[model samples]
Target chain A: MSEHIRIVLVNTTHPGNIGGVARAMKNMGLSDLCLVSPKLFPHPDADARASGATDVLESAQVVASIDEALADCELVFGTSARERHIPWPLVDPRELAAIAAPLKGKAKVAIMFGREDRGLTNEELQRCHHHVHIPAVESFSSLNIAAAVQVISYELRMAELADQAGEKPQWGTQWDIELAEQRELELMFEHLERTLVKIDFLDPDNPRQLMPRLRRLLQRAVPDKVEVNVLRGILKAVERKMESAEKNGNDHV
Target chain B: MSEHIRIVLVNTTHPGNIGGVARAMKNMGLSDLCLVSPKLFPHPDADARASGATDVLESAQVVASIDEALADCELVFGTSARERHIPWPLVDPRELAAIAAPLKGKAKVAIMFGREDRGLTNEELQRCHHHVHIPAVESFSSLNIAAAVQVISYELRMAELADQAGEKPQWGTQWDIELAEQRELELMFEHLERTLVKIDFLDPDNPRQLMPRLRRLLQRAVPDKVEVNVLRGILKAVERKMESAEKNGNDHV
Candidate 1:
C-alpha cells in the first residue's frame, strides 16, 4: 500500500534534509522517493542524517525536473507555505491522508516538497490539483524540510494503520467511477479553455481569474473519469457549433 | 494557549536534536521547552539546527531530573518508542492532541521525549498519565528525536486550530460564502440541463443518466453560493453562444 505513495523533494539544498526525509519516509512505511534537481545527493551529511534508512536514500530516483518526477503520478499534491490571492483547493495533512488513503490500490499519489529555503515556485504549485499546508504558526510558519516530511508521513501512517484496524472512516460512498487522473483533467481543461475562447465567453487576451476560478471549483469537485469525458463532450459540441457558425459567416461572434 | 503546553527532552544525547526540537516546537506555535539533564546545552550545533527559532532555545529551562522538568504540570505524556510489558494508557499523537487540546487554560501539560538511543524508561513511563506512541513502521519503529517532536507538535497545532474554529473545520481558513441553498441548487440544475440540451450534449428525449451523474458530481463538491453563481454564469454563456449559432441557421445540431 505504501509503495503507491511517492515523496518528491524539489531542488533540496541540504543533503542532510534529503537524508532526514528518507528516514521519516521509512519510519512511516513509505519507500518511494524522487529527487528533482537536488543541489546535493549521496553526500555524507545526507547519509549520516538518514541513519538506518540509508536504503531509502540508496534507492531514491534522481530526476532533472518536476514533470519527470510526477510523470506517472495519478494524484499530485504540492506543499504550500504562503496563501495566494486566488484560492486553490487546500487540505491539511490529515485531510490529505483521508483523501489519498482510499485510493491506495487505484492511484499513484505524489506529495511534493519544495526547496529548503523558498519552497515551491508559483508555477510549480499551479501544476498540482491541490495544495497541502501544514498548519504551523504564522509567525514561524516555515518548517524544516525534513520536519515537514515527518509530520505528513506520520499522518499517512496513522490513516493506514486505522485502515488495517478496520477503523477507517468512509469518505463518501465508495467511488463508483474511477477518479480522473492528472493528465486526463489537464486535457479536459485545455479543451474547455479553447471552447470558451471560441465562443467569446472568455477573452483570451485577458483571461485573468476565469481559468483559475474554474480550476478551483472543478478541482474541488474532484471529477471522475466519466465526468471528465462528459465535460469534454460538452466542449466538443460547443466547438463544432462554433466552427459551423463561422463557416456560415454568422459574424456575430 | 501554546505557552501552557511544554515539551520536555529527558537525557538527550545530541545537542543538535535538541535544537531541531526547538525549531519544530516554534513552527507549531509551542514555546515552553524544558531539558532534563541533557548531555549538552547552548551548543553551536543546537543553535544551527534551531534555524531562526533560537529564541525557543534561549528561553528553554534546563533541569536535572524528570521530577524537576515536569514540576508544575497538571498532565504529563511520555513518548515511548518501545512497547512495555505492562499495559498502560497509550494514545497515538492524534489522540494525544484530542485529549490535550481541550485542557487549554485549565491545565499545564508537559510532553516528554526520552533519549535518542532508547525512549523513556519503564520508570519514566510510569510518570506519565498516558504513553504517547507515534505509530511508526513496526520494523523500523524508532524515529529521530526531532522528527518525533515535529509530528507531535504538528498534531497539537492541528487540534488547536480546530479548537479555534469552534467546530472541526476542514482546516485552514473558513469558507467565505454560505453554501448554495436547496432552491438555488435546483434552479442551477434546471439551467444546466437547458444548456446541456441546447448544446446537444444531453438529449432531452433520452437524457438517460447524464443529468443524474453530473448532479452527483456537483453535489459531492458542495459548492458555495458564489461558486454556484459562477457555474450558472458559465451556463448562461453557453446558452447565448448556442442561441447565436442556432439563429444563424447553421444548426448542424
Candidate 2:
C-alpha cells in the first residue's frame, strides 16, 4: 500500500512547501513523492521545513508535468479547494482513500496536488479520475498546499493501517450490509404486502403510504434470515388460527 | 452547540487568515468569531480571502487580549502544531468535540489559535483546560491557522450532527455496568488488599506497586454495583474457606 501511494505535487512554488509535503508524507508512513515542476528544489528552506525527513526530499522524483508524474498510475485523484464547473467524481480525502485501498495491488495510485496560488485548474483537475475536496470551512477555504498534502496523506495512511489490521474499509460498497440481497429483500417485501392484503390489514386500493412505511420499518430492523423466517411463521400461524376458527364456526352453524 | 463555540484567534498577523478563520467557522455552522489583537482587520485582502464567508467576518468580535476573548469560556482548548516542553492534557480533535458537546449549555467553549509566525506562548497554553493537536505529517507539521480552524470546526460540526442524531460521544466517563461509586470501590480495594495480605498473596511491606496495578485494572474495567458486590461475595467466600481450612488442619494436627 505504501508503495502504491505516489504523491504528486504539481507546479509547487515554494521549496519549503515541497519539503513540508515530504515530512507530512513520512509522518504517515508514505514515502513515494513526485514533484511536477517545483520552482525550486533542494533549497535550505525546504530542508528546514522538512525537519528530519530530508531523506524523503533526497529521494523525491522531480518530473516535468502531472501526466509524466502519473503516467503509469491506474488511479489518480486531484486535490482541489474550489468546486469546478466541470462534472467529475467528487470525493473527500477519506472517500479518496477508500477508493485507493482496494485498487492497491491492481493500480498505481497517484494523489495530485495543485499549485498553492490558484490550485488545480479545471484542465489539470480533468486529467485525474476524481476530484477530492478536503471539506474546508466555507468562509475561508484556502488550505496551505502542504497542509492539503498532509491531510490527504493522513487519510491514505489511516486507510492503509485499516487494511493491515484487516478491518473492513469504510465508505465502499463492500461495507454496505443490506438485510438481504436487494432482490431477496424485494421479494420478501412483496410477500409481506400480499399477506397484509389477504389478512385485511392493508386497504389494497389505497395501500401506497402503508406499504412504504412497512418497508421502512422492515429496513430499519434489517431482519436476518432467521428473523425473517420467524416473522413469516408468525403470519402463517395467525392465518391458520383464523382459518380454523372460521371452519369450526361454519361446521357448528 | 454552534452557538456555544467561541472561536478565539490570538495575535493573528494576516487579516486574510482572520477572514478565512471566520469562513471556516461559518462552514462548520459555528458563528462565534473572536479575534485577539490581530495585525490587520477590515482589510480588503481579508474580504477577498473570506470568499463567501464575509457574513462571519462582518459579525466577528475583535478583542484586546486572548484572556478577554476566553474570559467567559468554561472549556478552552488551544490548538498547537508544535509539541510543548511540558505535556498538557492533550486531546485529538474528536475528543475535543466530545468535551465541547456536553459543555454547550453549561459554558462557552473556546478554541484558540495563535500567531502564524510564533504559536501560542506556554502561558497562553496553560490557560487552556486542554490542548488539541491535529495529527499531521511529522516531517512537515506546519498547518496554516485557517486550515487548522477548518479541521477543528469540521470535527465539531460532525460531533454536533452525531449528537443531534442521538449518537454516543467518543470520550468521557461512560456509565459502566460494573462500576461502583469511587468511595465504595476504594473501600473494596482496601478490603481486597487486606485479604490478599492475610492469604500471603500480597506482601504487606511492598504492596504499593501491586495495589496500584490492581486498582488500575479495576478502574479500567469500570465495574458496576452488581459486579462489585459479586467480587465482594467471592472474596468473603474465599476468606471463609481459608478460615475453615485452617481450623480443619489444626484439628487434624
lDDT of 2: 0.69
What's model 1's lDDT at A220?
73
Model 2 lDDT at residue A83: 66
- Which residue ranges in model 2 land beyond 4 Å of their true spot? A1-4, A9-64, A80-90, A99-107, A114-130, A136-147, A157-253, B13-29, B39-58, B81-87, B101-107, B115-118, B137-142, B160-164, B167-253
Q: Write the per-residue lDDT of candidate 1 for residues B193-216, one digit (tens) a residue.
A: 988777678888888999998898
TM-score of chain B of 2: 0.65
- Candidate 1: list runs displaced more than 4 Å: A126-129, A167-171, A250-253, B65-67, B71-75, B85-89, B98-109, B121-130, B159-165, B168-172, B176-178, B239-253
Which lDDT tens digits does candidate 1 get at residues A167-186?
43234556677778777888
Q: Write the per-residue lDDT of candidate 2 for residues B113-158, one digit (tens) a residue.
A: 9888788897677556567877665555656677677667767866
